[model samples]
Target: MNTAPHSLRPLGCLKAGLRQARQQRALLCRQMATTTSSTISSSSQTAPDHGFYKITDPKTQRLRSAFAVYSPSAIATSPSALAPLIQPSTSSNPSGALARLIVSPASPDPLPALHQVQIKRMDPTGARTALFAKTRHAARVGDVLMVTHRRGGEPFAGVCISIRRAGIDTAILLRNHMGKVGVEMWYKIYNKNVAGIEIVKRRAKRARRARLTYMRQAKHDMGSVSDIVFAWKKTRKVMTTRGGGGGGQRLVVVLRRRRRRGSRSREMREGVGERRGRGEGGVDGNRLCSCYLFC
Candidate 1:
């Protein structure tokens, strides 16, 4: 009975040792898992610095810090990797590095940016804005306007009937009379072919509507404005001359000679010998006569 108890004591000691070994192994595995998870979380929270950093050597115990130089092949192959390293542009000039990058030769699509630049160049003075503004001085419907074409043609003077406010494509409709016939035309305000626009006359009274399409009818029609245009031109003929006495300026009457409409025989007779001599008609027969009036 003594020998049997001693043999069972050895078996119990072996079972306790096995349980302790299993518990130690589980604790070691849990510690390793926690260490790995902490490393992963720290790496994810911190952002990598693309700038210079110090590198410490384990063997020599030396520290080195310098700018990192990348090869052209690496830059070409992995542009996204190096994108964060490039700094944003700070210059205000249009010919700066960023501007050159956007307008680079490598770009296949640059028409949209180029078109916006062209639109800005087309209206540099903001004259189109003033002409279509809602202010008291701005042009309105029923106001007489004269538009001159760069390409040779008679200037068109008409009343503004409608205005379309489309960006880069703004246009105005004008109606006028020619030889007892009503004529209407559309003029693009920012067109390259339009030389200039002049306000010939303002409306005596404001119109009741935005568009004056009712003026097209015979009953509401405004007759030919040619007489008013001629009167305006006559008023613009007064000239100013500076005096040498006190540096004061005086108004002068500029008399313009009118060509006589007569028979061919009469024109031939007047051109024969009368034009060669500077008689009472002045130095050049067609020269303007200035009559100075002291102010």
Candidate 2:
């Protein structure tokens, strides 16, 4: 009985220890849960509301919430008071609608406005119209074109093989032969680096296809066009000399001669000839005179 009591005492102590351990584990789990809940609540309270309007801070150069400038309470209390602050939309005032949409309580879609701005910036000069329009003189496939660079290099002359027209992203492919090797280049038409584009030679006959890729073969190739380009440039120079202010130099020489004659007549009227004369009628008898020839 004494041994039985001793063994029973050990089992009871083990049960008590297990119960205390379980209680400690439960207390630890409860503390962790409480801490996590507190952290989550604090984070929720401090989180920034991205739905609100944002204004740029001039001093910090950062975007901040506009709650201070436009409070919800003020908007709710006197909606009518802010009506005058909003620009009135009218048919005569195109920008009024944009202004109202920006300052309104709701967020406005920016896609339409951005698209208009992009379209306006794409082709401000209407050069694309003159180049790609469906007219008789517009640049087309198989036409020789010269592209000059704004930074100054030898102008590239080539046969236009293909044209890709995608609004601001329009481009053209040109092919030429250099040192018996074929060379090709792609040029963006509206790029700022491109100085000018001129049609050098039109095709003898209209190309049956849009892209002249078949010209890459030996049988269909047009070969080196350097001679044609040189002749065209020479002819252009001759035409410019004949028509563009070529007579202005001659007219200037004639004007200079007339001014000289007028100055001589003025000097004669001032009695300069009489002062130097050796005989009557303001004449030097021994000197040969050219006044009669001038008269």
Candidate 3:
């Protein structure tokens, strides 16, 4: 076979090899330029330094020491997430006030927190004393109560006839019999003069109605008041005493002794009689003396 000249070999193969070499060089240059731009951008984005060296860096090894110096709760901006949003309602004692007796911060222990209820009518001349409950839950329907009146020396022992439980204006109806006569007394539960209320017995019956009105017409059952007992707490009185020499203040309580009825009037009568004796000797003087003493 005859050999062809090397220069005269296919001119198309030589042109294709030159074109491929140019394309590889262009791709290499583009990749090098892209990698250089990314490195420069990353180095320029460093964070600014704060003056406090202890908390500034994790590499300093003292960031935890600064955090331990402060209390988390002292700087907190919100209340505890677990606490309830509303307070539960409680029954009020006779002083037209509601108070809770708390024993400690960690544990809230309940105790008897009310005392001494007296009632006054719209007329200034009328006043009465009745038995009072120390707390709302301390008194209930179908209970026997011993009420001591301010005027009468003897106590009125009765069964709770009815109860009107309007918040702040709660009252109880009490019933007792004098021979053949039935007597009923409606007492405001929160009065200040109610000397004391002692729950002698609690009836076994659980009354559905808050008021025990059915007891009024029904015949008496002697067995209803037996075999049940409950303990009661007396209401507390706040008595203030003045400090002597004034270094520190002290609290003192004074117990009130029961007073007899009409003793106050008798004292006023004796004073008026003496005043009349010194002023004149006439019918007008005698009448004035008697009016002040007796009426």
Question: Candidate 3 lDDT, tens digit per residue, 1-295?
Answer: 2445665566767767765665554344333332143442332122211222344346743233332222212222234311211121233331211122231123222221112112233212222222233333354677776665556586565677677764336677777665656677877645544454556555555567776666667465332332222122111111112123431233211111112334575664454445335434533432111100001
In model 1, where do residues sit more than 4 Å from their true spots?
1-119, 239-295
Residue 90 error, candidate 3, Å: 39
Better of 1 and 2 by TM-score: 2
lDDT tens per residue, model 1, 117-191: 666788677666566668766777888877788886998888899888766677888888999999998998778
Q: Arrange candidates, best TM-score first.
A: 2, 1, 3
Q: Any runs in candidate 3 off by more than 4 Å, and if so which?
A: 1-137, 218-295
Clashes of each: 0, 0, 10
RMSDs, each prediction? 24.0, 22.7, 29.1
TM-score of each predicted structure versus truth: 0.44, 0.47, 0.30
Residues forming the 10-long window of minimal summed lDDT in candidate 2: 286-295
Write candidate 2's Cα lDDT for 129-199 as tens digits.
45765666578889887888878888787899999875556788988887798888899876767777777
Best by lDDT: 2
- Check candidate 2 and list the clashing pairs: none
